[model samples]
Target chain A: MLLKAEKITKQFLRESRNTNQFCAVQETDFTLEAGSFAILTGRSGSGKSTFLHMLSGLMTPTSGRVLIQEKEIYSLSDKDLSAFRNQHIGVIPQGQSALYSLNVLENICLPYTLYHKNAHQEEALALMEQLEIAHLQAAYPSELSGGELRRMAIARAFLRKPELILADEPTSDLDDENTKIVFAFLQKAAREGAAVLAVTHETDVSQFADKVFCMKAGVLTEQNSL
Target chain B: MKLANSLPVRNLKGKPVRTAVLLLLTTLLTLTVFGGTLMIISLKTGLHSLESRLGADIMVVPYEATTKSNLETIVLQGATGYFYMDNEKYQKIASCEGIGQISAQFFLASASSGCCSLSVQIIGFDPDTDFTITPWIKKSYAQNLQKFDIVVGNDLNAFVGDTLTFYGVDCHVAAKLDKTGTSFDTAVFTNSETIKALIQSSVDKNMNEFKNINPDAVVSCVLINVAEGYTVEEVLNDINIHVKKVKAIQTKDMISGVSDSLSGIADIISLLIAVVWIAGIIILLLAFTMSVNERKKEFAVLRMLGASQRKLAAMVMQEALLVCLLGSLLGIGLGLLILLPFNQLIEELLNLPFLLPSAGQMLTDTIAAVLVSVLSGGIAVSASAFRISRMDTALILRGEN
Candidate 1:
């Protein structure tokens, strides 16, 4: 197994409500195997992004544990956990995720630079070429179009070549052609033995996913593989 | 990777206006601190040097000189003038009950004529009986002054071995005195014999203030030190009662006025420094807080990209440190350029003695000002850095909060 969640849940306090408590994600048990491409589909406010955040070690679960490769990630110290995430997990967050101050090339190499490590420029250039963003490497995020920014974020997520890739609504701003390019990239990474899990509302994602799941009202259920 | 390519430097380089404004704020902070401190120290040093240079406990001048305030102008305000009383009055002051030591001095003023380069005060002290000017002059010239040898003050244009002509009488400079930051710096000092010759030359040239008077029969002033177990006021009253045509004034009384003015100016500079310091810190705090708040999403993205909370906070502090370091150095450089070159003008404007501190002291003050400025900038941004580091990454990335 590449990633696993056992009875994980997230609750938020509702200050103005009489109940004074809200469950963003109910009890869920999930696992992702190596070399598998999984797609999570849900409506707005279905807690799909919340679940992906927990798996990426960004949001802490209110109950139970998150294990990646049989190691409980939340049990580690903040320093050790961040280092582990930097080396083994790659996340492509939703919306515009550029650091604004950095150009496209520096933003893509941030994961390596954050640890004061030397970045492999040739590999980063190859990824940019594959995403058709090689010509825009020297351009700042503000100068790029929405589709270009999304492609840049995807390129940055795959820079470290992590074993597991978690993407939250990664293709929400892409057109049909660019959406196909992004899905094909994720599918290719999965074929190369990286476990890829992505949350999206696009109907065409089923064609690329090996397994599919649907979430509703904070609950999750596995759907038959397409 | 080099630090020049780091995120903080890139951020500052990307927004030129914001970086410039922050740099200017810190520059104002350090300028006020360093300049104000140096001014206060110089004033205090000048006052202390003036006090020690006025070696007499009591001075007896001709009574008319006090009525015209001529002695005060010549001594305290750096003006040039001369007056004389009968030498018999000096003997009377010497025979007063509580006198420990007594010395008579002759004063003359050089004319701004073709023979002289500049008009200056010429003070002649009795070599055998003098106790005040000799000790100070000895620090520069050890040997006894020859008949026509002269000692020039620190601010005078004359140097050792140079000849200065007063009333057609040329006098050779023996040594230059150390700076006392007083009117004495502009005067020339010589023994009684050389000055009497100059005085006779003045009489011959029709420049003598006292017409038909013998130079050997009149002395300009008498300086006295009170005996042990006798207070300065007691001897001052004794001289006033016994002396016929002279005024007895305590040296301390002459200096009290200058001290009061110096104290008032020091207080105002200190208050100005406090006001600027407080205002700078408050403005910096507001600027950093607003900047960090507006960039919450950017930091949240870094968090999602595997940056720890510590790294996020350190990046913010590093940006502030870079601005403060550069700003403080610029401020200190500006302070030196303004304060040192125009010090003489400042002294004249305030009408008080002013001396700069030693070079080592100035170096220490420079370091202290830079450290204080950088530390205050750090303190101003600490709260904002801490708040941003603890922000909710998931909500910020989702645009939920």
Candidate 2:
């Protein structure tokens, strides 16, 4: 497995009520290979985002292990995890579109700037051209069409050439034609040797992935082929 | 100012109101601390100048100490205060090895002018022999030097050239000094011979008591100027051994008895200003903390970008230092503006007699303000950054409440 999780669970505690802890997700187990795109899908409140956060190492499970490239990422310190998030992995958080201050190119080059990695503008331009969104490269997010903005978000997520990429409801606002185009870019990213794990309640993005996992009550069940 | 180098700077322009408020508050705090400190510095400067002008190496007077000083009658006005020692003792006191020069001064009682009975004191000093009177004589020698010539101190110049009949003795103002802001500034200077002649005239005016008076016992106090090799202590010991019936006191002993009480009052005024300075710092700290809290996501984002907490703390401190430096500069400028002219007013209030912070003192105080502001900001930044860094990155990523 290129990425792995074992017996992972998460808990939420109440400070005001002094009540016992409640579980957000429990005993979550999943793995994905390097070149496959997987979708973790569930209805709202079914812990899909929580599971995705754990898989990306942004949130640590209460009592389990998450390994990427044979290193237990959750066991690493916060400093190391930040380093990991900057380079070895990528995340596209929902609601906030490509950082409010950045132009599309700047947003695409964020991982390089954040990690102090090589300023690979040539590679970013190549990716933009490869994904057919090079025309919108200089535009700020506010100036882009919804389809172009979705493409911009994806460019940022895959900026670092990470071993894995995680996206949360990335195309929820995109049109059907734009959704197909986004899935094509994501599939291309997987074929280019990065694992893409997408969390969505929408079935359209799920059908594009090679593998799909449905989550419920903190449990995830994998589908062999979507 | 080019965009290439101003991307980070442009971030401030992105939110002008917040940045302006932050800058304004920082300026106010800096100005307050520096302004108050500058005032204290100005007061001290005034006091130092007054001390410089006093020019007395040693003073001899009764032990009763108070703050008020009158340059004229006490020095010019003879027979005003308690002790009237025999002027003949000046000769014996001068015999001491360390006794290089001495001036005998007499304080004559208050005299009435044309309309209002103004408070007056006068002093008597031999401009030819007295060390204390010699320095003052230089100030008057330019205008007109006469046996009965008088150089009025700065404040007494208000009554300058006003022909005042002191016990029916007449003298004209030969020159007047710029106010020293000391009690001396309120006193008039006349020739020692003229003052003696006036006092003897006054004594003679009360002609019934002429039989009981002693002619040799004339002046008020002997101001001793000790030699360079010896201190006032040796001179005091010498004078006590050689002379009889006169007490000797060093300049500082005199100041401690007089100026110290007045300075004690000024010290309280400075303390109140210091409170305002401290309050300004505390307010600045609170503003910085609020700014830090508001920019949590910004710091978190920076942290994720490998910007260390140390760097973040340094940035805050640097900003604070800049604010402090700018504020302190503005304050020093404002202080100098207030002092360069109104210095006389401050001296009058503090009884320093003159005040102006020097360029060197301004530089030192600016450096000190910068150091203090940055240190305070660094501490505040570290405090808030501790809370910020401890936050789960997941909270930011998830956009959780």
Candidate 3:
């Protein structure tokens, strides 16, 4: 397995609420195998994004362990964990993830720059071409449309060619044609032996996944094989 | 990546207005610090120079000269004036008890000199028995001063080999003395013979204010050092009581007024520096905090993209470091441009002595000011950098903050 979660849970304190405690994600056991595409579907406030953040090593679980490549990721120091994430995992965050100061090309090459390595410009350009954003490489995020920005974030996520891809609402602002382009690219990456997990409410996303799951009221359940 | 293409540099370059504002704030901070420090140092230096150049414990002047405050005005305020007493009075002061060393001096004033349009004070000393002006003048001109050869003060507009005409007598400039940062820098120094000739020439041209006085039989004032076994008060009392027409004054009493004024000005400059420093740091703190708070999502995105917390903090500090380093250099440059060139004007305005420190001292001060400015900038941004580094990345990305 490329990724696994065992009895992961998240709780937040609510000072104004009577209970004074809120569980955003209940106990959950999950695993993602290599070379497979998975889809997580849920309503608003269903804790889908929270779960993805935990898997991406961004949010710590209140209880339980997250294992990537059979090693507990949260047990590592912050420096080692960040380095591991940079080398093995790529995340497509929701809602305008571009750095704003950087143009589209530099944003796509940021993962390499962070580690002081030479950016793979050829790979970035190819990904941009595949997403139909090649012509906008020199444009800043503010100058791009919503659909273009979403496409740019997709291109950046795939720049490192990591083992696992976690995308949160990656296609929320995309049009029908651009959404088709993004799904096709993720499906292609999965075919090439990268485990891809994307959270989305789009009904058409199910067709591109090998397995589908649904979340409700902080509870997650496996639905069916696509 | 090269530093020019680094994320922090790119961020600052992307927002020109914000970068400019931060740069301007640091510039103001450094300007006040460097400029105020240099001014205080110069004032202190000038005061010390004045004290050393006075070089006498007791000065006996004609009583009428004290009544008119002519001696004080000429020595402390750089005003040009002359007073004379009979040679008999000088002999009486020399014969007084508790006197260790004594020298007689003659004074003359020129309405307009050869080198400039300003009136100049001409002081003549007896080289054979003098203990004050000769030792100081020898630092610049070691050769024995001839009858008409004069040594000009540093502030004079005359140079060595230049001839200055005063009261229809031509005097050759032998050398120019170093700056004393006192009224002495504006005077002309020559031997008693040359000054006597100038005095006689003034009387011949009807320029002498005191008519029917013989130039050869009169002296301007007597400078005295107290004998080692006696106090200055004893010598001053002996001279004042024994002399018929002269008043004895202590040099320290004359300089006390100047010292008090210098102390007051130093305190004010120090207070101004403290206020500007405190206000600058506070304003910088607020600026950094607000800027970090406004960019929560951007930093959150970097965190999600695998930037370590340390990296985030370092980037913020790097921006501040760049601004402070550049701003401090600019401020020091501005300080030198304004302070050094207009130092004379500043001295005149404050009516105090002003001298710049040596080149090495100035260099050390420059380095210290830059380090202080940059360190203060670091301190100002440290809190904001820490807060941003430990922020909740998930919530920030979710737009909850």
| All candidates: DockQ | 0.72, 0.20, 0.74
- Judged by whole-model lDDT over C-alpha atoms, candidate 1 comes out at 0.90
Comparison by DockQ, 1 against 3, better one: 3
Here the TM-score of candidate 1's chain B is 0.93
Candidate 1: pairs in clash? none
Cα-based TM-score, every candidate: 0.94, 0.70, 0.96
Winning model by DockQ: 3
Deviation in angstroms for A203 in model 1? 1.9
* Candidate 1 Cα deviation (angstroms), residue A69: 2.5
The docking quality of candidate 2, as DockQ, is 0.20
Candidate 1 residue-wise lDDT, A1-226, digit = tens: 8899999999988878857788989999999999999999999999999999999999999997999989899998878788888888989999999988889998999889888888777888899999999999999999999999999998888999999999999899689998899999999999999999999999877999999999998899999875
* Candidate 3 local lDDT, B1-401, one digit each (tens): 78899889998888788888988988888888998899888988998888778789988889977653556678887898889999999888988888899999999888798786799999999998898899999899999999999999899999999999998788999999999778888999999999999999898888989776788999998999988899999989988888888889898888788888998998998899899889988988998888888788988988887889999899899998898888899889999999989998899999998898888878988998899889988999999999988999988887876
> A130-195, model 3: which lDDT tens digit per residue?
989999999999999998998888888888989999999888867998888889889999999999
Q: After superposition, how far is residue A58 of candidate 3 from its true place, in Å?
A: 1.1
**Chain A (candidate 3) TM-score to true chain A:** 0.97
Tell how far residue B358 is off in model 3, in angstroms.
1.4
Candidate 2 chain A least-lDDT 10 residues: A92-101
